[model samples]
Target: MKLNKILVYVIMILVLITSCKKDIVAGEVQDTEKKIECEEVEETPKEIVIDIDDIYNSVDIDIGYVELENLNEDNVPEIDLEYYPKDGDFILKKVSDGYICVSLEEYEDENALEDYLSPMVYRFNENGKLSWKKHYDYKTHVGKIGQVLTFDDDSFIFHIDSYQDWNEGRLINDNCYLIKCNKDGEEEWTKEYSNSNRDMLANILLSDSEEILIIGEWKAKDGKEYDDIDKGLKEELNNDIVITKLDAEGNMIEQKSFGGSNDEHVDIVGYDKKLGIIIEAISFSNDGPFAVDIIDKWNNDFIACIDEKNLEIKWIYRLVGGKYTTNNRFSINNGMVYMIVTQNNRNRQHSQSLITIDDKGNASKLITQTYDQMVDKFNSLMILQNGDIVIGEGNQYISSLRIFDDTGKVKKVIHDINLVPDEIIPTDDGGFIVKSRRQIKTVPQPIYVSCIWYDTELVMMKYDSNYNIEWRKTYDRYKNNPYWDCVIPLNNGKQITEIKTDYRKSCID
Candidate 1:
């Protein structure tokens, strides 16, 4: 912009001198005013039109990567040992005066896969070119990083839970860590939090005052594979909210565990000064009818609760999932809670619940809808800037981004993506960026990223916000993608995007 102004001034001076026909413009004040007006218009910076195809022309995913379970290869639904099928990363945030994206990348090394947390962050120039890259311990247990968060312009934070190797530590060796990485993709510091039994990193809210509030699971279980799947994947039994508060420099200020031994999940948020209370929407298996069995958690749903400020029960709200409920979804915004639960009668279906729990934890069910194609079975809550909600339908195929007012009425359905929207970001302008992918048919059966955008008009019929033809970019990763994927809008009129690539391949299971 400064350069634009300078060039404009120079052009104006040149025009004035040329127009000053010494003989005719000596007294022409009108000409001087016209020149000034022209100069002002020239001083304004023009919105530079950019094209996507010119930027990220194409990508080549390294061969022999293994993350995807390989749903299709040699015509079989189940996967063999060779398919590196992993999901793309989700979550995008503003970085510095620009944007920093935290997507996933895969690298295979038999010795390296043990560390659990390996694939790291890659920095991009303002023009969206890959600048440098960083990685975590590509050694022990192959740390599964989650919830990559940007704390500020020059740095970011993410979670890492190292698994128990064949060597040392307890059965489920774990410690939740809050790491700080520099601009050049360097780990500056890290704060570790753990308990005697089982502690798994879940989510975090980096505060406005540079203080970070970390939320996760503090579960206790044995070493059996069934026990491992129950706690790690199914999120069954051993429930406790693991809360760790730390400053910007990675110093743990306060740490505690809250919740019962059944269900405790934390979706965190914070600014910079204080670590806010945990608004945990809990589901107890103890309630409901007697038709429930320990081996099958398919019949569990109860009152959701919030655990915060030590083990204090801030509030509790009842959520009825009927007799044939599979799972339920809930979220908190502006001290309010919204939930969605699935009901199975003849076939499976879902309903979105908009509820508000007061300070005492008493919940008021406001709106409930069994409307669309399929609500996201995993999660269906997105709060807009104006307090409106954009909810999804089902996990396999999120039919629409249904809008709801504060009163919880189905207002409208913005851009509809047939598959699950892995990520949706509200842009500064009255628009949004949606990033998702679908399974494709190929030898390795690649997954293609499907990107779309919707303007303020709230219509899915139209989707061109640029002067170019193709408004979205797609990528195909055949194997080994065990990380996040996102589209970053940078300040320099470019999109900073990352895809899963570069796998080193492991020798054993």
Candidate 2:
């Protein structure tokens, strides 16, 4: 009986050992399955490689006026013109489809001597094909379209200066209009603001909440009566700055004006929901210099911050100097304002200086770079995400782009003889897109005789993180009129620019 009981106990122990071995194998299998599942869940994103050759080859150079004429296609519609249509102002914004361009156009009136200006907006597909176009015209009034702001929903808002005069040549009325349109270029709503003062639209800003901010200059209606040599001209005119806010549906929520004695013209430099609005203005001096021969000159250049909610000035900083040219460029980044200002002397020699302003509106000069040899102008100024300031300075022939450190010292200079950089923008990959004009001439003349004498091309350059030129491509559609070229970068590492014809004849003979 004892031997039988011991054998039973041994059988039970063997059964227990077999169960333990099965549980261990199941746990290992479960862990391996979990590892496999995790490996399937995570994925590495694919990198987008842009084919430079493909993009270059896709350019439609035959779409311009001259090319269309050469084709003798009557189906093509005439593009509207503004004054010098070839030199019209344009604003470009990237959309999902591609790019939307809003341009100011002036049309020649067969009955009248002066041409009437209007606004035209065009939509293009991802491959740069024209999808649709919307042209706005107020039969009698001339329109000067200023800027366009696009929303996430693919809708856009554009502002224009609308004015009309009596047949007797006396000014009747002038007004500003804001028009909102849908993705199809159909007008959703239009708002017109009529003020006793003459107002000019400067720029449109998009807020963090997707609201619209209209910035402009306002001059008293009485100011138009004063002559150039009038002693009380500055006192008579109430030149001020105007700021207006609009909701998503084109409703004005708030409007405010700020100014003091002396003629003041304000420009909206930057704005943020948290930091409010930043503006730069110039106040003309009344007593300093006055003559019929002399034109308008500024006495004080000031920068100010305004509260977004209250519309009250938070702080004001001023830099006193001689005449301040319109080439002033300023940008705001990380609570700091960077500016490039040109001060003109009595001899018409201009000197450019770089300065910075803190959140408190305290102004400090970074470095004063003078251009005594030729007419040096600041074409573009941009602050990188890493706090570096890049400035493009150029004359008619040569151009240089200088990268300045955070402390305002020149870190490096990128120079080219024939390239005139008109604009520079930062890319997501820590590089830059330089929109420049390349002029090729036979001799090193101070000035090219005519558009026909020289070959000109619009250049788009891509730079690496180390500021090395990766590749560059040029377009010769509007070879002579580089001023009309507007290059906008796309999210997919592509670009779109204006294409026109060089209609002017060459004076080579």
Candidate 3:
């Protein structure tokens, strides 16, 4: 036949060249498995570079809180400074071979007040030198040194505030001292408390069986005790809201008072081994003159829950808003209780509300968040250890730091242009430590005459678990106001702030 039809066309061209070499080896094995899954997603590791440049050390000492102990057995970190001295009458004594600043010799006549303000305690030594000091003179005429509770057997507690001139200078009154030192700073017991009207203190909590919960703002020794509350309320405001529980040897055991008629204050006191004492207040249903010229008409925001064995009042959540609320900020994890709520209109803050409350108090309102066009101002609120909910907003030129997730949503916002946060601290590697300041304010013109002038600086930022900004520091100290910086974070990663520049140069001289 023609040689069997040319061998059947060469066996159909060898089966079409083996199906084009199996489709080019299946597209080069699917592009080599997508290049080994993109090199394992670029070797995954998101960010953490911390080298804060030896954490800025500056100490002329006027600070009021900064603690990080190891005291000298030398595992490093030994900064504990809480100073006070603008012009001295000295008393810094601690001797086992290291501190002795005693210099009191200027009490010459006419009431002897050559600027002697007292309450000091320094102990630095990680190269900032000076390893011991202690001073506390009650020759008061005004003093404050609140919050400094450290102990794991190093013992310490001082939440002071003294004022003096009781009924003699016709009344000046102020007292809320707690003082309990020892780690060689000496003094063991001081607990004061006072009342005859006008008390101040504001917040302190320590419990885990060590108990100390304070909270303040009470003022009534004259408004006729509102004839014993609730008759239909409106007894014309007198402040009120005090809680006191002490004992770890500061002894006061139990004391309570909460108001209802008009002004109530107490803005935070937490504790939760299952939600026992949580009080956060701001009540005022009418303090007359149409609640001070109608700007939201009157306040009302409560959240109570006391009863860690008879402190009474188990649950109360009231929120009745109308717009003007104020800087409230809170946090408590696992058992709930978040609360943020800012909302304002008498000039600024435009909206914010987080609200969570649980452990039986119920209340929910997880996220309201609004800031109209920016004048934002609620500064601090943290709750992270993984439940994540950090928030801190500011004004006069940027300062943000949002981060929310746990269903509250927002998840990360940072910002920080002129800096102003007041405190944030949350780390263990999930990074965050903000404490900002930087104010500027200069008005001085005839533009509606109000006379303003400030300058302050004092920021300290350090973030990383991906919110990256591994370091930032500022410290001009003060020029017109704010000076209460406190940073403390060490275990070798370095950080210890609170340089209170002599109370901002004694408030600009």
- Most lDDT-accurate candidate: 2
Prediction RMSDs, each to the true structure: 22.1, 28.4, 25.3
The digit string of per-residue lDDT tens for model 2 on 1-509 reads: 45335534655655566677767986897789887775445546344343323322343212111110122223212232222223345666777766787766665558866666667887877666677777786433555565678899899988776666675667756566778999898899988766343354576788878878777667642323222335555556666577878889988888776554455677556885656788777666343111112224455666778877767778876655563423555788887877776776666466777777787777787878665535555768888767888888775356788888889888889885346667777877777777665554322323323322234555666666777766666556543343334445543446654444445322110
| Tens-digit lDDT string for candidate 3 (1-509) | 34234434544544455565666876797689887774433345334332212111121212222221212223322344345344433333323333333322222346664443456666544444566665675544555554666655656676555556544447656555667877766888986666342255667777667787776666542233433555455444477676778787787887766664456676667788678778766666355211322224334556777876567777777665554335555778877888776655555436777778887888777678666534555667878778888877775355677888878888778774455566777777777767665543332233224323334556566676777766665555433445434344542334654443454223211
Q: Give the residue spans of candidate 2 off by over 4 A.
A: 1-90, 103-120, 134-141, 163-175, 195-200, 220-237, 284-298, 321-326, 342-352, 368-379, 394-398, 409-411, 438-456, 478-492, 497-509
Alpha carbon lDDT of residue 204, candidate 2?
Answer: 76
Residue 338 error, candidate 1, Å: 2.6
Return the TM-score for candidate 2, rounded to 2 decimals.
0.65
Residue 225 displacement in candidate 3 (angstroms): 12
State which candidate has the highest TM-score: 2
Clashing pairs in 3: none
lDDT of 1 by residue, 79-151 (tens): 1111122333334445664344453445565765343434456554444445555556533343455667775
Order of quality (TM-score):
2, 1, 3
By how many angstroms RMSD does model 2 differ from the true structure?
28.4
> lDDT value for candidate 2?
0.62
